[model samples]
Target: MARGLGATVRRFPAGDLAALEAMLTEAPPGVSKMICMDGVNSMTGNTPNLVAFAALAREHGALLYVDDAHGFGVIGERSATEASPYGHRGNSIVAHAGETYDGIVLVGGFSKAYSSLLAFLAVPTWLKDHLKVAAAPYLFSGPSPIASLATVLSGFDVNAARGDAIRADLHAKTAKVLATTTALRLATPNTSGLPIIELPLANPDDIDGVGHFLFDAGIYVTLAAYPLVPRSEVGFRVQITAANGDDEIDELCTTLRALAERFELQRHAELPAQGRRIGSATPDAEVRLSA
Candidate 1:
């Protein structure tokens, strides 16, 4: 793939449109095919600027493909295959249904939001012939296991019926947790149903200490350290679910606040900071007023 793309595989920092544009514009001359994005990109906690990136790729005469594994049922209405409200309008724009963005392809899976193990793809009609001829896996692989297929189909039906109620519960639980965490002065990013809370600790000792403390207190959150995140960004990762009621969330928050107070967690850092700009190398050119 790298050789096919002129021996270069360009990667852009997620959520940065300027960087994505620059990469697309500067890709080696002969490169024509480009895989623009993966499902829910881990780093940015978003789909990475897919809508804008898709337009840019087409302008540059390249093919764009997106894996909607992490976003399919978690984004649009009815959890339709679309970008997170934060990303692009996903499967909504395929050409088959008289939509714009004629040739884009989206790979969907039932694993994340639907909580199933089946996977599927959405491709344009023109590509069907090509896929039949060039796609080796589809041509050579045996039929899907009957029992597994039946179970998956059954799960899909259940998901379609109960999806709304499930999503509502998820949203309520997420909102409760987020509000509680914010009140407790824990830094967390705004997200949809994925209740991932990341707490950045200063060092490995702090990470270990916090993990042990939480475990002893009957709460379990993952401790992540260097290599996973830089040494400077080590912390704990907590995942919440709909099963967590308001009382449980409150308890978790209370426990976190107590721990923070005991450990002297930097609450000030948890609050959002105002943006500032330094004038030049030779100090400030003019006095800046604080808002």
Candidate 2:
């Protein structure tokens, strides 16, 4: 894609704000640069600082492009009248980011948060025409059929009426699991109250064994390796959805706790900082945040 567009692709360390700023300062001339990143990173399950990145991009006279595939329905704004079960207390990173600077662009996919296919883009009015012509995927792809559109519409309607309720349930399920398990870590920041959690092993290579162990026990999760995260740690991610039942949540938590004892899962340095952590529902489990 970069070759087709006559652009040079530069790779950087993940979430390294200092290095990013350095690169921005060193760039020559009036070259238009875009900071392309994930809203809630998929591999590590970390919620990127959209506001800070936006501010940095604005400072550098550049554009910010966020792929909010994991955030759309899960981490964004909650209802005003009620509260999320996990004590989430803010708007979606994008919603809270404000629209003062229209230079930011956001793309979100339906697979994770919406349980659908394809993706959507949010852009300012000024860029619509340019993007239509310049975006290769949009120009070359076939349109989704009416049936899929109908389903998306239906999904939207369903979300509109019951999204908050589902979000609450999702948080509750996550809280339940976290309360019981201590071996693995939660990748999402405690302040974010996100449902995506991760557990890292002392040895990076143990991830495959842990993944297979979970699979045999009737639970499925993703085992991520290098490039997704630093090679020093190999981790698996578990996503909590509103669709999950209490029994399922309980069983997974119980099994993970057992494995933590078996494998002696130890704490790592890459864990996100904690806000106010939710305690275990069960006694003796007492889940503690590393930092």
Candidate 3:
């Protein structure tokens, strides 16, 4: 029988393989269950690595599980990418892997891209029989609620038809925001939609002060500091969506620049030397004697 054990691990950002290699080396022999979040869902935006990792797990005799909540309706050919214009391949890492992972398990929720309160799970045929017989939830729940099921199924159909168009619009809007920020010489990393603009500050108090200033200016952005990131890294997180227009993007950038200037955020100056007078009759020899 299989070991019937599992481990959940996060993939790296920009598809770094060093961490994943280390994880596999450290895992106990005969370990079977492995779970991962599909691209752009976590800190990592890479999806190709997930496919590669899934293949590696299979070779090591482990069952691979993926929660493609963020990828399912947002990536691939039909996603925000320039290549795929239809919604068929949007955010679907497993789908992109083709028939190689025919028996993989996938989980997705509708709360994010669809903005609905529904969840779903897809089990491959090999495990379907086992899930029907051995799965505790399936055994106890009897059947899924009719209303919720209908809503979820309906959402699937709707997304299938229009997902591509929505993703394209989102990408376009995000590009506009990036261009505007770049023109202003702001520190903005190229990302899918979650853009964290680093503020030039040396302390957490400054981050709070900046956040408050933006809020008062009628622009709301998340203030991220230590624990969420690190003490050395502080920034305002901006969530971009298709609904925001070009004008809105421009306004946000303008407001941010104005607020930064108002706070004198960039005007840091070196303090005067201790025990030194700006204008005094004391001779240079007297000042040198202190040393």
TM-score to native of every candidate shown: 0.72, 0.83, 0.67
lDDT ranking of the models:
2, 1, 3
To one decimal, what is the Cα RMSD in angstroms of model 2 from the true structure?
A: 5.4
Q: Is candidate 2 or candidate 3 better by TM-score?
A: 2
* Tens digits of per-residue lDDT for model 1, 162-243: 6445545655665566566567665543332245556665445577678778888878777777788776557776666556
Superposed by TM-score, candidate 1 places the C-alpha of residue 169 at a distance from the truth, in angstroms, of: 1.4
Which stretches in model 2 have alpha-carbon errors above 4 Å?
78-82, 85-92, 96-101, 183-191, 225-231, 268-273, 276-291
Worst ten-residue run, lDDT, model 1? 282-291
Winning candidate number (lDDT): 2
| Model 2 agreement with the true structure over 1-291: per-residue lDDT tens digits | 765687767876656678899999888879888888887666444556566778899999888888878877665542345556222332244763333446788887777767777677787777888989877878998997677677767878877787767777887787677655433553333334457776666677677678778898999887767667675556677877787788889888888876776664546445433334422221111123432
Better of 1 and 2 by TM-score: 2
Steric clash pairs (candidate 2)? 76-92, 77-92
Q: Please identify which of the two predictions, 1 or 3, would achieve the higher TM-score against the true structure.
A: 1
Report how far off residue 214 is in candidate 3 (Å). 3.2
Tens digit per residue, CA lDDT, model 3, 143-212: 6567767876786786678766676676666556655555544433222332223344445557877888
